[model samples]
Target: MNEHAVDILTELRDLVREFVRERDWEKFHTPKNLAVSLSVEAAELLEPFQWLATGENGELSAAKLDHVRHEAADVFIYLIGLADRLDIDLSSAVREKIAMNRAKYPAEKVRGDARKYTDYD
Candidate 1:
């Protein structure tokens, strides 16, 4: 992470850490288990988007949107827990990934195209 980047993740991570510590649930929150939990939460988050046609308006009712938000939060929280257990720096990882993607899909070559990098030729 860059020095100028906000330190918001630390606070959120600590909150998750404290919540786990208080519940004495660390024993059950193994890296593998956390990864599984994160995936499960992600699947749950996808529930709100299911059964929609390709052109269907994604806007949902207020209550259903709230449900989506809660499920999405569960996915994020579990991901933070998994990353904490794995000692992964998500900010740096994301930044590096974005850089790599930019290299793979240069604007000049990829402009107005949706092809894969391997198909650029």
Candidate 2:
């Protein structure tokens, strides 16, 4: 990832820490709570597209898109908080996951296919 992106994440992490500290919410930000909160926010993110056939096409009304944007931010915030509590570097973790996925789903073997890697065997 670019340095700018890493810097932004660091800035966000610090912002979240300050926000939590100011609110005296550190006691409530246990890894389990953050994990559950992350899941809840992620589920909320799907609400805008729950009944839409074209949801997969990225076609959402402006209002629905705005709702999704906020929900996505919530999910992202909780994710950052969770990573912070665990001392995990989000960017590096993402890079490692991408590398692992590339090995599991090689472009030549999985072109235009959406099946799991094990399904091909």
Candidate 3:
């Protein structure tokens, strides 16, 4: 079954949760280990772009983009798995953080500016 765009994230998250459960790997997925894995995967995603010159972040070749895509998926999988084990609701957590960021970076003061939020003061 196809998931709608708004539902796909949750659907993929549930799929990862079920895949881990069926394999009985819960004991192997402590938050610390998952966090480590997530960081490692994120680093791997950066590998293909590491040697690119300036202004090259958007210039990845098709093959490199595919590699980046897979590594990013790995990061997302581990992140959701970690969140599931911690009993965190991913959507609400992200929403709350976004709200905090919005408060810290009001558009009137921050628009077109890339400085840190404190710079808005």
TM-score of each: 0.85, 0.96, 0.85
Clash pairs, model 2 backbone: none
Candidate 2 worst ten-residue window by lDDT: 50-59
Q: Candidate 2, residues 1-121: lDDT per residue as tens digits?
A: 9999999999999999999999999999999999999999999999999879877546798889899889999999999999999999999999999999999999999999999899997
TM-score of candidate 3 on Cα atoms, chains taken together: 0.85
Give the per-residue lDDT digits (tens) of candidate 1, residues 1-121.
6554537787778999999999999999999999899889888877767775541345566666887789888888888898899999878878999999999999988999998999867
lDDT of 2 at 44: 96
- Rank the candidate models, highest TM-score first: 2, 1, 3
State model 2's lDDT.
0.96
Candidate 3 has which clashing residue pairs, if any? none
**The candidate that achieves the highest TM-score relative to the unseen native structure:** 2
Deviation of model 2 at 69, angstroms = 0.1
Best by lDDT: 2
| Candidate 2 wrong stretches, greater than 4 Å | 56-58
